[model samples]
Target: MELRFIEINNLVLHEYTEKIRFQKLITKIEEEGVQKSPIIVTKIDNYYLVLDGAHRYTCLKALKYKYILCQIINSEEYYIDTWQHTISKDDYANHIQILLKNERFSKLDSEKDKDILQINTMNDENTPEPLESYIQFVDCLNKCNSFKRVHKNEYSKDSVKVIYPEVDEELIKLLVNKNRRIPAGISKVNLKCGRILGVSIPLQILNENTFHDIYIDKIMNNIRKYEETIYLYEGMIL
Candidate 1:
């Protein structure tokens, strides 16, 4: 409950696990300064352990800020609910590769061979080759109503193909829905890959009820519509 400024170096991270930070986010903080939200930390064994806001911590550290605004709380006083990603980093990389393989894009041989894929724009003078084509490809995947439905094991399915110019607003809405149905997190999608892909909402952000009240209201209302038979059947009754 007590909000105070703490030195960046004094903060300790979770020893067993860590979260990824976004360079763009760090850059934003540097340009605009840290926003109003205070990072949450708890005092344990004379050290402050970051309960949430790892990215913010990293960003502030990168900016070489001597102090950061934070909320100090007792660990026992707060309950933590952690969410793990269903898709691992390697799985996501493989998915991207599989999607690229099915496309008409050309692969350029780089010095490091960093799995860089390029799109051939020899025919269209106006079309951007690499980055633009990459964005187009990702946008195409996002438009597929079945993309989200596909299981992780099916990423390599031969039929998996990227379609273009068809944007499914409804599918996008479902994919990004803040309701409990879809997990919220910071997305790893970036310009390096030519688009945004995943969501990685921090636990602190998720704790804010107001941040998702509207979506939760809609979800709860939808469930109440079937409240009469919601638990009547276990499996497919028809």
Candidate 2:
């Protein structure tokens, strides 16, 4: 594997499915003055498609860097896959804010003056009426059948379990069946417990199609049971 510094304009992003909402990440990168991970890419039809590290790519792009460090790979030899949080810590409070501002909450009709939900004051026991309604709204979002591929991540033994909202199952099925790529930013939500954030469409790619059923089932089961740990490929192989 050769590490190369390629011009940003030369790379093509195909089937990328993660969002680039990394304000904190960008700040960290600026502070550190270096990127920790080199993006992985494969050349297809003379265009380099990013196989991983789209977030890092966006960060560098936002930083106005002309060239990026990358690990170029032979597409035929290695399979590319992705595992991402449907909802990250940064999205938790934002989702709550969306629910609060949405007009669907009838209970909040009288509180028209209030736009933001004060999450710090609410908990399972002493949650305010408006906040409780927001929690139910988030629950409804998760229970929708339209979302097929969802997963939960419990970071540690004592961490709270977070559930993602429902995503368009048919859309995912179509993408996989057609052997196409999934795009970034499906849907994002937060857990009712206020402990974990949800990511609606955490995508995966495989070199061989043989692992589809096994992995798909794993994601579905994780959504059903809110699994604590999720397995995905993460490494900087030389």
Index of the highest-TM-score prediction? 2
Model 1 has an lDDT value of 0.42
lDDT of 2 by residue, 100-212 (tens): 45444322221234332112212233433323443354443343323223343313221112332223323233333444444453333221221111212111121234444
Least lDDT summed over 10 consecutive residues: which range in candidate 2? 194-203
Candidate 1 lDDT over residue span 129-153, tens digit each: 3234434344433333333223323
Model 2: number of backbone collisions: 8
Estimate the TM-score of every prediction: 0.36, 0.38
lDDT of 2 at 45: 52
Worst lDDT run of 10 residues, candidate 1, spans 188-197
